[model samples]
Target: MNRHESMLRIAASSDISVLLLGESGSGKEVAARFVHAHSKRAGGPFIALNCGAIAKGLTESILEGHRKGAFTGAVDERLGVVRSADHGTLFLDEIGEMPFEIQCKLLRILQERAVMPLGSCDPQPVDFRLICATNRNLRAEVHAGRFREDLYFRLNVFPVKIPPLREREDFNTIAQEIWKEIADHNPLNASEIALLSKRKWPGNVRQLKNVLQRYSLLKPYDITLGNVLTDEFSEPATVADTCTLYQAKSRRIAETPEWNLICSELSKNSGNKSVTAQKLGISRGCLNYQIRKHSS
Candidate 1:
């Protein structure tokens, strides 16, 4: 089953803290948002914080809020993300980077259902579900004493592993969905999809999005696979003596009356820009440009 479907099933039945594990750009945050949207707390605030992005010294202040004059620049009292997410969900992205001391504090809150804000004498009760994401292997961190075992167990009550795009069966479906959203200004044709699907996308979804954006801006009218790979599609130098065979293929594409017709055929197969671009053996931008050019 797809990640969304699997997550939907989990969200409908559980209130356990969830841990979303995946590589960067693998849409772990998107999965977290989907879980929140599908859960009972859909109407409540869904606050997201990047644990690794926050500064080391200010981490406590950021998560637990600080009263006015709590620190050097504390001008006004502010609600920490934990308290603000009361009756809602808090998504902590990159939780593996959080300091061990902070993890201990977080474990206390989870165990006591209360938080002690900075510069505050009292501990306030809190009620919110927690979702944490990380790209690192926490088990490895635990071995090195960088992560707390008890905290890990508490947060990992229900773990959801978001598979990378390379392993996903719904890649084409998701690609088409993202393409429609991005290609509203410029439509794609058949040749583009074939070419796009053939490439090894190292950056996954983010890389795909960027390529489409660039294609839309650079060659909105006449994008083609050849145009996208013109600079990088060189033949192996060792086979230079026998390169005439490959050159013959290029000549065939150049001379054939069916070349444009083939592109048209591929475009019809997958109207999405990324897919079409893949089919055309070019970047999405090249396909987008060609589409605009042909349409115009």
Candidate 2:
């Protein structure tokens, strides 16, 4: 992680385009902001737009601006995202979701360092750092003919893949820092951090921070991390009414996936059933009950 941060710091020193690759909720935007904050354009505007959220048929106008009366909704002239980002940084999230037709327009802007707004024949010069992020594999998208190959190569100049939380070696340290930040410097005990570090944390740091936030709120009421986490993993609010509650839960456990998950947790905890139960966000008693029932 330190190495990755160093790489980002280096990338910030230049105007080269950057492409961040990571799973959803894995802090790609945070990384982008880090680069922007450290870059020479820190004083300039930082314009962010989610390509996936761009409304269809309005991509050009939204990205390159539009003159007054250019289209049905163009009641007034507007400086779009590209122009707004001039002399600063433009962060495009979910770049892989950008429509195919708009890709060529974006490539022209990158190649020419200017934008010609809709209904305008003259191109207005734009100078800004480009940082694009996406969870999708752009190479695969390009191969599938959904993404432009030329555009992918342009954005992939300094690609950096953000590692997921579960794969980070500093998970425990991260949890500690988040607790201190959210809980007014009152640190989580070592055991609490240990229990937290054992979970898969599928939602990555975002999910861990959320769990810590809840734990911080409940800490003043004399609650433990185990209690907070148990509540965190409680069953969904809605369930089928076709069977008894216990039967429904047991049925879930009897399924191959759920049973395999339990076994996997047990193995990961080195055969320590209690630790496995904590990692699975269930009481040790419940884990034992299910294990005994299913063992037969």
Candidate 3:
């Protein structure tokens, strides 16, 4: 881990573009933020945009800004994302998902250090450090003709590969850390931590955090972590027990920060279920379950 940090620091010392390669939910964005926080542009803005989340047909206007009256819906001028990070860092998450058409424009901007906004013939100078992250293999994408080879070479200047959580050597420490962050008032014992370390954690750290969040929520109701893990809470409940559980869940959902986070993310994603689920680090099914349970 120290070695990884040193490598990131070395990359951060210069203005070289960084390409973070990792599995989803493996903390690639966190790593990107760390680089931005440590870089010379740390004092400047750190703009993050999920390439996959950008609405279709709005890529150019969103990334390069737009002049007023550039399009049918253009009523106001915009600064766009690339210009927004001038003198700072721009983190592009899920860069692999960026459309092939926009890739060329991005490469041109990087080469020229300027952006040509929509409906503008003049190119405006811009200065910013770029950090891109993705779970897909750019080489494979390039071979598949889905990604541009020139762009891949340009962005892979300082490649950093973050390993999945299950492969990490410090699972226990990570689990304990997440538990502290999410359920500090209800610390896990050594045995519990060991049990966590033994699991596959297919969803990586994000999944572990979700498990801890569920445990914390159910603890006050005398629910055991084991039951939570096994989804035993879904078993049939007696009439009295059902009423109690319903009341408890209603109050918890109302007060728990995660519920509000869900609503906020859902709104931000324009109510796109797949995007919202991915952003929240939960499965689509899990998101649907929460909606069914709380949307009433």
Candidate 3, 1-296: lDDT as tens digits: 65556788899889999999988888888888899888889999999999988886898888899999999999999989999999999999999999898899889989999988988999989999999999999999999999999999999999998878878887778787888888636468887876677777668878888989988766654455775665532557776675454464345434433878999999999999899987876556556667766966
- After superposition on all C-alphas, the RMSD of every candidate to the true structure, in Å, is 9.7, 12.8, 13.3
lDDT (C-alpha) at residue 225 in model 1 = 44
- Window of ten residues with lowest summed lDDT in model 3: 248-257
- Per-residue error (Å), model 2, residue 17: 0.8
lDDT value, candidate 1, whole model: 0.74
Return model 1's CA RMSD, one decimal: 9.7
Off by over 4 Å in 3: 232-296
Q: How far is candidate 2 from the true structure (C-alpha RMSD, Å)?
A: 12.8
Q: Which ten residues in a row have the lowest lDDT in candidate 1?
A: 248-257
Query: What is the alpha-carbon lDDT for the whole of candidate 3?
Result: 0.83
- Assess each prediction's global lDDT (C-alpha) against the native: 0.74, 0.83, 0.83
Per-residue lDDT of 26 in model 3:
85
- Predicted structure 2: clash tally: 0
Task: For each candidate, give its TM-score against the true structure.
Answer: 0.74, 0.76, 0.76
> How far off is residue 167 in model 3, in Å?
1.6
Q: Give candidate 2 misplaced runs (Cα > 4 Å).
A: 233-296
